[model samples]
Target: MARVVWHVPVTTSGPGSTTALRLFRLRDGRRCAVGFSSPAALAALLGPDQAHTELGEPALHALTTPLGVDVLVLDPRLVAPPVTAPATPAAPAPTALLQHR
Candidate 1:
C-alpha cells in the first residue's frame, strides 16, 4: 500500500512561548518527524485563551472536524526545482581590424 504523509501545524504555550509544531502521519500507522519553525509572530495568529493539546490517533479521530491546526500533505520524494544561472552577455567577436590595431 502507498503511504500518505500529512504535515500538521500545532500550537502550544510554554517556555519558548511560540512555536510551529509539525505532525507527520502515514497511512499504515507509521509516522515520522518533518520540520518546524519558531516564529514569535505565530502567537498573534492565535486567539486569546485558546486551549491547545496534542492527542494520539484515538483523540484525533474523535473530533468531527478540523480544529486550529492546518494540515498539509507532503510528497515523499520532495525536491526543489533547480535554480538556473543568470544569463551573461556574450563578449562581442573581436574585429580583425581592431585586433590588428
Candidate 2:
C-alpha cells in the first residue's frame, strides 16, 4: 500500500493534547488513525459540528464520503520540518532629518 501524508496546524483551543482515530479498508486490512493534538484543536480544525460527529462515528463518514481513503492521525515527529528563513533584526528607520522634507 502507498503511504500518503497530510499535515494541518493545531488550533489554539486544544493545546498540548493529541487524539487519533483509526480507519480500515478491509476487515483485516491495515488500519490507520488520524491524530490531533487535542479534541478542541481537532474540532477547531474540522469545525465544531463536524468534530462532534467525527468522534461519535466509527469510520469517519466524511473521509470516505469525499473519497475512499481512510483518515489517519500521525505523530508530530513524523511530520516534516518547516521550511523557514532565519529571523533577522529589523533595520532602524531613517532619521526624519535624513528624509527629503
* Among all candidates shown, the one with the greatest TM-score: 2
TM-scores for every candidate against the unseen true structure: 0.24, 0.26
Q: lDDT value for candidate 1?
A: 0.40
lDDT by residue (1-101, candidate 2, tens digit) is: 54332333322346556543333233456444454545576555455654332232234445444455554443323334678876997788887555565
Candidate 2, residue 26: the lDDT equals: 30
lDDT of candidate 1 at residue 88, scale 0 to 100: 95
Q: Which stretches of candidate 2 lie over 4 Å from their true place?
A: 1-37, 43-53, 61-66, 74-78, 86-101
Residue range with the least summed lDDT across 10 consecutive positions in model 1: 34-43
True-structure RMSD, every candidate? 13.7, 12.5
Please give the lDDT score at residue 32 for candidate 1.
39
Candidate 1 Cα errors over 4 Å, as ranges: 1-15, 22-75, 89-101
On lDDT, the leading prediction is 2
lDDT of each candidate versus the true structure: 0.40, 0.44
Candidate 2 is scored at a TM of 0.26
